[model samples]
Target: EDRLLPLSVEISEIEALGGPLLLHSWREGIDDVDNDGEADEWEYSIMREITPMKENGTVKIDFPSLELVANGEFGKVSLYITGTDLAGHPVLNGGAPGVDNDMATLVTQDDLPTTISQPSISLDRWGNNLLVGQIHEFSFSLTDDNGIGSIDNISIALAPGDSRGDIWLDPLSRELSVNDNSPIHPVGLVIDELAAGSYKVKIQFRLGVDSPQSWNTSTQKPSVIVTEHGQVLELGSNSLSHLEWTVDGRVNLMLLSADDLSPPHSELFGNTLYLQPDDRFNFSGQLHHPANGLNVILDGDWQVNFSMDDNQNNAENWYTILSDSSSFMATSEIPQSRWNHGSATVQATIVGGVQTIPITDMKLHIVIDSTPPQLDFPVTTLSTINSNQMMQQLVTIRVNEAGGMGQNPLELHWSFRRHGVEISNMHGAAQLPLATDAEGLWTYSTRIDFDVNSDLLLPGDDLVIWVVGADLAGHPLEGIGTEGNSKMTQLRVIYFQPVLSELTVSPYQPTIESVFTIDGRVLNEGNDMGVVKVGLWAWQSSGNGGRYHILNETNLTLLPQQHAFFTFSQEAWDSGDLQLYIAINDDDTNLTSVPVGLVREQTTGEILWQNIDSPAAVGLMILLISVVLMVVTAAIRRSDEEWDDMDEEEIPPPPPWAPDEWPEGAGPPPEILTQSTSLLEEE
Candidate 1:
């Protein structure tokens, strides 16, 4: 068993022996978790009782209970008792005598007369209108003849009601002696979250037992009138008193003139208003208080201004104070020259009493675009379409507006006219698709179908087209047309068929071996430009009703009202009567044929005739001529024999009777004999 000695020493005597009494390694198996080579985990405390050969127990120090009582000229004075133990811990139930809790208590001394005065209330802005849902501060001074320390509990209540629970006080009640060093104690009370109503503040004070007094009941109570936010209140000829009051809220603004079919077109998207320059616009607004649900009137005037920088000092005057009413209406216009593009701020300022307040909620952001959208037709004026065939042409228009085109759809208006007369059934408007390029330029394009069947457009018919739309700022498109004077583009419908005329073959009566040229003129009768194919064809008269064959073909490109001459050459072979003509665009010209008796030489002295009506009669005529030639040759032979027998000298006279140079129709036709003699000489 370990031996321990009992010792009793005063704290001053222990400090005089040394600075302090300290023990090391007071407990075994104490771990130094921090590895600092010290047993710091064990708790060190002064022991109230000593123990040996056993585990140490918790030590507690008890302090003596205290009670305080005072009697003053005011009455049995109220006292608040509070103290801490030797270890600086708060004493439980440490208050005035006979109190079960720690709260301050009042002493009972019925023999003394009460001398404490009631609290005097001094509101921050007394008799002034208070705004609902806002915090209002007021103070009350408590006094006593003996000092404010003699006063104890204070209670505050609202007369009529506190049922809605909308009103709240920061410090609900004052307990005990709030200020013991001062003769008067001023307590500030903050009233917050108050609803709209009228009430009287009732204050009660307690200096001793049965010493409670009501301040409002003893004097004339000042009423606290809480008004709805934004509700205007009369200042009661005390303008100086309103200097301490705050005027705050917002303004709800709207544009009254923004509508369809009006100048100065405007559109509102969220909080921003887009505007286009025109003549003028009407603006209206009403004052709104956020604290309460009400539209309130301004006590003074309302002014409006427009600024590019959102600063009132740099803003331009838009509207002056014309009325003192809460709601306002004004007319204003933005000049095109002054504001061509970009944004501006429209601010409203309220002049109330002697204070000028700018309502941030009243400011509206406006995007002004004064520049009108420009229109351009890439394929403009004098376009042609074929009426004979169906075709689709892309009509494109370029729109140049810096403010961009709005989300509204664009329309293409077109009208069809024939001979300067409008065709009602062919005129209408259609939505056009828009596209944007890398350069930020917008273009609208639509494919227009031009069909004679569907459109009923004939040659010389004109179609006019234009675009109509507005930009983001509601600026209308200007000069949007395909032609001059901002009018529409005219697309003329025309037929591209080619007409052939003046068909003529060289040497109208052609021989079988002759090369004949067929010449003709191709004219484009329609108001269209294209290639026209012209073909040369020949028809030979045979037993079987004339066989047709194409001789030659050529392509000729012709413009509207333009003519081109085409020629084709072909070797006419084995032809009796040949009909030749020029064909163009699926149409034929007048037929021209080669007549008979146009002869061509096959071999020397061999004749081939073209366009012969009878071949057997020609063969009989050849046989008769052959028989006459034989008889003449026989007579010439006999005459030659007789002449030979007569005399050799007589041969000179026989020269005049040359058989080769006979008269016409002797031996053969004179032309044939001469052609044979000439052919023999060339051979």
Candidate 2:
């Protein structure tokens, strides 16, 4: 019977191994599928199977081989074990199943890793033709199949004569090779080197591998292209394979690489720039110096400076690439002259760089305004005595333009003064009823009334109407400063009614010393009655007979339909034949006075005078007065009664009524019967 035996190898032989064996050992990887600390039994199976020679009848086995992976990477490897039984039949206890079943019988436990896989490479540059000073970086990663080893001991070499080969690799990238010395694993690498020649870089490297007995090796090759200094690598219009540039004249400015380019953290290699004839200037505010307030202006050449936190600090700095300030024409005009107002960019380059960058599209804005409205109106007086009263005038304000005009409602500042003396300030809107209309060609007006007793307003009184318009934007338009302010208009409220005529006093020719009463009447003969104000004073004329004067004016309510009365005492009259003068104002334009015949009243009862008259004349006057009285009486009586008083029979009363005269079979009429009989019995 066969029994299992403990197996092991001397540690010294492991170190003495060399060449392929050592390389194989180094390449071999460890695996522990179940996470146990100890190596899996299957790991020693391969070594045990590598037994002694058949003639010696000694069993022998070779070490299992694997590869290394980078740090933190998983590695893996697989092996087949075969053997024969004593009867000469192949030993089959855990042999792989038939082709159809193809199941693996060997088992493993623990987390040990197995084989290492080569890393991939990525190359990038900002522009075509990498310059000597410009560093190009190539990136790659190493990986493995199992969890055991690391990428330690991997050596990356650059084939000489290559542009990338002539430069130094980043130290950090070099350190990726020595991460783990245990077994097969992967590593990440970056090469940041550049030279002055176009090159096809071949990245060659050897990585650590592992075996059940010792160590092993694995190698890989990755390649990329690079350019030498001063070489113009022209990326075709559509080809982003190379770096891009913005070139104007001899200067070149590199556009960031299409691959792996981000703005906030993006790096810039050069500062001086130029514009190329073929490329369009496309710039965005983001690329411009930040403090410029994002505004840039391109006058002849470019005169706009970036704004600093303080404008005084940075305003003077200007950017002009090619032509002198006076010679260069602005390529484009945005909504506003300011570039910051618009999205814009420059297709430019650094002198001799011959590179171009596409400036993304940028934006511009424009802004118009108008003056406030003006007001003008006439001044007039409204007279109560005058039949035609003045209506309030409407006020309006006009604007020149819609924009920039304050869009608010109009407010009026109105004042009235007489004889250069200040009066009340009646301030109000032209929009409401108290004033007048607010629209139309700008003008505001309201009626002014004057009392007869009040200080009479004469011509030349200053009447001014003024206003300013405020827009919705709260901007007020001022005509005050410009030729526009007609500002104030002057006018007078005139009394334009005609004078009174035909003035007569009840008692004419009053005594020189007696207190004679006089009643006067005046008629408006002209177009209007400006006013009928009376003044009384005693006076005497030596030759023309004593004249009667006004003593006091009587207060009376004058209605529009008829004349208004004013009574004055004729007392203290010192005159021969009292002559009365009645003054009536037609208007500011006309004033007329009517003369009355004189009457000499010697006694109180004879103030009107008793003249000798014929009986015929008295009778005629009496008849006329009586006839007038009778007609008036009849008219008043006719108006008092609402209905006619005819009898019920004459009027043909309602259906139940009886007639006085019976027709054939009919009963007596209601007047004739007089409640003598009932037609129907009471219920």
Judging by lDDT against the true structure, name the best candidate. 1
TM-score of 1: 0.32
lDDT (tens digit, per residue) of candidate 2 on 282-371: 222222212222221111222222211112122212233433211122232222122222122333321211112222222211111123
**Pairs of colliding residues, candidate 1:** 576-611
Cα-based TM-score, every candidate: 0.32, 0.23
- Model 1 poorest 10 in a row by lDDT: 204-213
| Candidate 2's TM-score | 0.23
List runs of model 1 lying over 4 Å from the truth.
1-273, 277-366, 377-396, 415-430, 437-441, 445-464, 480-484, 487-621, 649-683
- lDDT of residue 597 for candidate 2: 41
Q: Kindly list the per-residue Cα lDDT of model 1 for residues 81-114, writing each as its tens digit.
A: 2333233333334233222322333332223112
Give the CA lDDT, 0 to 100, for residue 302 in model 2: 26
